[model samples]
Target chain A: MFNEYLTHIPFYEELTQPQKDLLAQNLAEQKLSAGQIVSSDSTSCKGFVLVMEGQLSVSMISQDGREAELFTLTKKEMCIFSASCLFLPSTFHVQITALTDSRILVIPSPIIAKLRENNIHVELFAYKTMTARFANVMAATEEILFVPVEKRLAKYLAAAQSPIKITQEELARKLGTAREVISRLLSSLRREGIIKTQRGEIRVLDAKKLELKM
Target chain B: MFNEYLTHIPFYEELTQPQKDLLAQNLAEQKLSAGQIVSSDSTSCKGFVLVMEGQLSVSMISQDGREAELFTLTKKEMCIFSASCLFLPSTFHVQITALTDSRILVIPSPIIAKLRENNIHVELFAYKTMTARFANVMAATEEILFVPVEKRLAKYLAAAQSPIKITQEELARKLGTAREVISRLLSSLRREGIIKTQRGEIRVLDAKKLELKM
Candidate 1:
């Protein structure tokens, strides 16, 4: 289990055996059922978790009473508050909810902080990982404004390598839009000869043309 | 001149003597009139510049030919690069251009790398500064998508604590929109008693209503 977690996180793989052992000793296993609030708003985060089994959705409530999905984390993924946990801050900004039945290895940030103080490699590794993650989020934000929603949907499909096979409600949650809006856009794209979609899966038929829109 | 630069940056007050000396030794002064490209696309970045006078717009062009302004740097501010600048294989993705008559201090990245290798304190200081800047950018991104454009306009106004005196073009650049679009929105807001504009200035009349919308 420990090895599998390390394999997905390249930085963790760089740690010496003893270092990994230290992390492993503090790792506590927990299971979260689908739709469970793994971490809630206004709660002080005690530690970060490594996804061993399921998916976690990072989201926040908009003033309009809608939940906006910021991002999602699958197996081997992490969250922003993972580092925030060590910083002794109160009240997290985002609420993380388990999207599916999942198992996670919870690692307290205090322990990680200790490891950082003692291990040069761990500090560098963690810093690099956080820095890269921050850059990805920033790039995503740029995409949201510069790229139109339809193109974003197209690129999301291209990256996932499949059209998300979920109900309209679920799709809206993922895309951060209304189901009617998504259905309308999908129909428009299909008419434009950019994509072909069945019940749940979507395939890009004209990548050249579709990419031009992006 | 040094005092002006230090007054603009929050960290200048805390920097060690050696760090300040290193920066002083490495800085190369540059003059750029409004609309001049400081760093163009298709060119490799040698280093970043510290703005000592006027404003510089950091932006990227999308596939569809729209320009998205990431941020603007002015007196006492520096624009290094995204983390991808170091690790990504692509050439510079954004172009830095002068928005007004400006003077800037250019410091090559090689010098920073060399200093980092020999000075542990300097390395840590650099990492901390980058991390904090990344966090601010991340917050700005979240504010954009989740918060309405008017709310965003309000936050910017509040932070600026001034009338919307910045040109509509500059406002669009900051908000990542077309100047025409920003003009239409501002007109609507003005009609609604949210703000008043004359010439180049904008005065906020209802911060509460603005916050409510956000």
Candidate 2:
């Protein structure tokens, strides 16, 4: 019944037949619509969540209601926030929201904890995933501290294949800056002939120049 | 023979007698002098290292030679970098340097891996340590992005029980900013009678005002 989602996760594929059967029997799948909050700062993790489809934005909102994007989780990636529950009893400090229609496979916390206890491969996979996410978070912090906004914006643009169909306000939220800041930076890039900004789209005119900015 | 160091680590206390004996037989200790490089950006991790004494600084250097402090590892803390090696063959992107004369216990990668496979408690402890470290790194990142230098400085002062004994350059490095910037901010704080700056010390005069800055 759960063969599709189970097979989608690489770590699940590493499990033995019996272990796979156990997980398949215990795991539950939940579908979330776009803009739906999957979890909040105070929410206790239900289980280890594996993304089978679509994207989830992991962010933190400050006391004054400012939000900062930490990173995004897409298909085949496991949620580090849930894995963190196995270790400490502290509440999660970030909020996870579905950026698109998403399907998530959740193995109950107790089952995951038991599997981690009994399975060496499961334990190692969990450790590795947590470590990689930590590294990525550190890199994000470094980028915010050292890299200029123009360089960051250029890199973001270059990552997209063609014109990006994202609004300035959305871009601002992703970059952890104000909308006016993004608009001013985009205007500067447009003036320099580096990018052409439309009503709701931004087209990279000179990829080489944008790369140089990074 | 390894009782002293093993007893120092809380996780080691939970291991069975046979498991402890196994670790004692396989683990090796090494002493490093201050300023010595523990690991570099491209070095493959040898094993899970436990700091038995002193401190280690983990930082990343940019192409232009700017350095950003990530976090530090002190006594009884396991090296999360080595745990990361269990996943894929990827190089560590940060440098680890001995901040003081230090003693480290290394359980060879294979030995640690084998133990993790056989021992459920060992696996759980590893997961917990990795999770805690990830949380810390994220908090550090958040401080750098969301908090201003003055507020960060104020918080640092509030955390310390007494006067902070550090140089301006060291302070700048810790805050991930320029020495000149720290100097200017300190001067302003001194003028406002919030803190008194000596050649190598910052004595907070008005703790109440300092807390308000944060």
Candidate 3:
């Protein structure tokens, strides 16, 4: 049963039979409903979280209560934030929320520590994955600093399916801006016939024009 | 002689004598003058870099020539970016420069790979260090997105020693903004008697005032 999820992870292929067995024996399965908070604020580590199904949104909150989406983890992706807790007893300042009904696998941190100790491939896999996530976060930061919001919004829309099911306030939080700013931008886009916005959804009317914006 | 640098790395203490001998034998020492570029675009990875002396500045440059400092690698710190190159071939978008005359230890990637295969402690150390750097980069990203430039500049001034040697252009690049904007802000701060600027230097006259801005 666990093999289904394990098969999707590229790192599992490199593990020896005993190593794989150890992993299978130690992992605990968890089911979470949509909108559930997985971890938040000073939460200690139970283990490494691997999303077997559904999406999880990870966000950072400022001291003044402002929040910004860092990135999202989906199927077969492991939580890089959880790995940070393995080496040191540190507070995880970020919050994680399940975006849909999800099935997750929790590998005990000590088992992970032991696996990393014994298996070079596992260690390498973890290092490479964590570094990749770091690079992605850095790229997102570059986009926030260098790219215009219009372009960012357009890119977000272009990548997303039509009829995006997100509120202006939520979009604002994701983009690190105020709801009014997002509303004003959407209003301008609506005037240009690039998109149509309703109470809790946005539909791209002209993807070509949106691409131009990007 | 290499043992001096090895002693500074906390992970070195956990290695067995044979592991330490292997590291000392395979490691190479490199000397870099201040202002030297350590790594740049499309540079292939030869090894993991460990700073044994002085500091290294890592900054990301955007397509339109905007630059932002990611973070600095100081003594006993390994370059996580370099390690990222070992698993897969990818362009390094960030440039690393020696902040001062420096000495670094280069551990051949193959040798490090071999050690990791044999020594679990080495593997654990690499994983932990990479995760730590990832967290630091994430924090820097959060600061860039949430904090105002004025506050960032103020915080920088408060933390810096008097008579900052960097030019306005360099400072602007580090702050992820245009030089003219930084100049204008500095002029305003100068008029308020918070800082004094001359040629390519800035002297914080009132740290308390700067802290207030932060």
Report the number of the highest-lDDT candidate.
Answer: 3
Candidate 3, residues B24-129: lDDT per residue as tens digits?
A: 8888889999988777665635567889899998787677866567789898887745555554334337777789999988888788788778776676666657
lDDT rank, highest first? Answer: 3, 2, 1
Please give the distance, in angstroms, between residue B156's alpha carbon in candidate 2 and its true position after superposition: 4.1
lDDT of 3 by residue, A134-191 (tens): 6676677767766767788888999999999999878976775556557778999999
Please compute and give the TM-score of the first chain of candidate 3 against the native first chain: 0.68
* Per-residue C-alpha lDDT of model 1 across residues B1-214, encoded as one tens digit per residue: 4555644544444556786677667767789899988875444355657788899887766666677676788787776652224433342256688999999877666666655566554344444455555566555555555665566766777677756578887896687445555777788878889888888788989877766665
TM-score of chain B of 3: 0.69
**Candidate 2, which segments miss by more than 4 Å at Cα?**
A9-27, A88-92, A110-125, A145-213, B1-3, B6-26, B42-44, B63-65, B80-92, B110-127, B147-150, B156-173, B176-210
**How would you encode candidate 2's per-residue C-alpha lDDT over A62-178 as one tens digit per residue?**
655556777899988878565455644353367788899999988887887777776766776666666666667667665665576677888889998788999998897677555
* A-chain TM-score of every model: 0.60, 0.67, 0.68
Model 2 clash pairs are none
User: Candidate 1's residue-wise lDDT over A1-214, tens digit each?
Assistant: 5655656654566667887788877877789899987775445354677788989887755446456565788987865455554432232255678899998877676777777677665555555555555555556655655666676676666666554465655665566444555777778889998878787667688777776766
Task: Indicate which candidate wins on DockQ.
Answer: 3
The lDDT of model 2 is: 0.74
